[model samples]
Target: MNILFIEDDRMNRRVVRDMLDVAGATMTEAESAEEGLQLIDTQDFDMILVDLRMPGMDGITAIGHIRAREDEKAKLPIIVVTADAAVDLRDRCIEAGADDVIFKPVAMDALFDAMGRLLARDSDGMLY
Candidate 1:
């Protein structure tokens, strides 16, 4: 599957990229929310993984912008990756249109499971 991963941290990006590579999934990395938004506009992806905290245009704002799109891409499955596990943050992400939230340091199995579930739901036409 084609996945877009938006993260500001180089190490985190490398780690997720390696994991996705080993899983035979293609990943495109974005260093910031602006870059991620631009990529979303110009590319097609099966899923999007966004980091919640960044220097500018945080993931929540990014998600809002994505959901604001009038195209079908607005409904693309979005997973928020965050180090902060605050309840309010999770709620905010969900309210902002994230399909799921995964905490860091992410476990490979959990990430895969979440991806699989979302992808399955999407393919089954159960996801919006």
Candidate 2:
């Protein structure tokens, strides 16, 4: 599957990229929300992984833009990755249409499992 990853931290980006690569998925990386949005406009990806705490146009905003698109692109799966493990934060992301949320200091197994679940969800259109 082709995945777009939006992350600002260099180390975190690298870790996620490596994990995705090792998982055998092709990935495209974006260091900021603007870049991520631009990529969304220009390419096709099976899924998107976004970081919540970014300098500008955070993950929530990014998801909004994606969902605002026409029907075809709007159906893409979006997962929010954040260090904030607060209950309310996860709730907010879910309410805003995020498919899933992952905690920071990312665990390889956790990420893989979450990615698999998100990507392999049934055709019934359930986000998670």
* Top candidate when judged by lDDT against the true structure: 1
Candidate 1's displacement at residue 33, Å, is: 0.4
Tens digit of per-residue lDDT, candidate 2, span 49-124:
9998899898898888888888677878888989987769988998887988889889999888888787677777
Write model 1 residue lDDT over 38-86, tens digit each, in one string: 9999999989999989998999999999999999889889999999978
| Model 1: residue 8 alpha-carbon error in angstroms | 0.3
Question: Considering summed lDDT, which 10 consecutive residues are worst modelled in model 1?
Answer: 119-128
Off by over 4 Å in 2: 126-128
* Lowest summed lDDT window (length 10), candidate 2: 119-128
Please give the distance, in angstroms, between residue 65's alpha carbon in candidate 2 and its true position after superposition.
0.8
Model 1 regions lying over 4 Å from their true place = 122-128
> How much does candidate 1 score in TM-score?
0.93
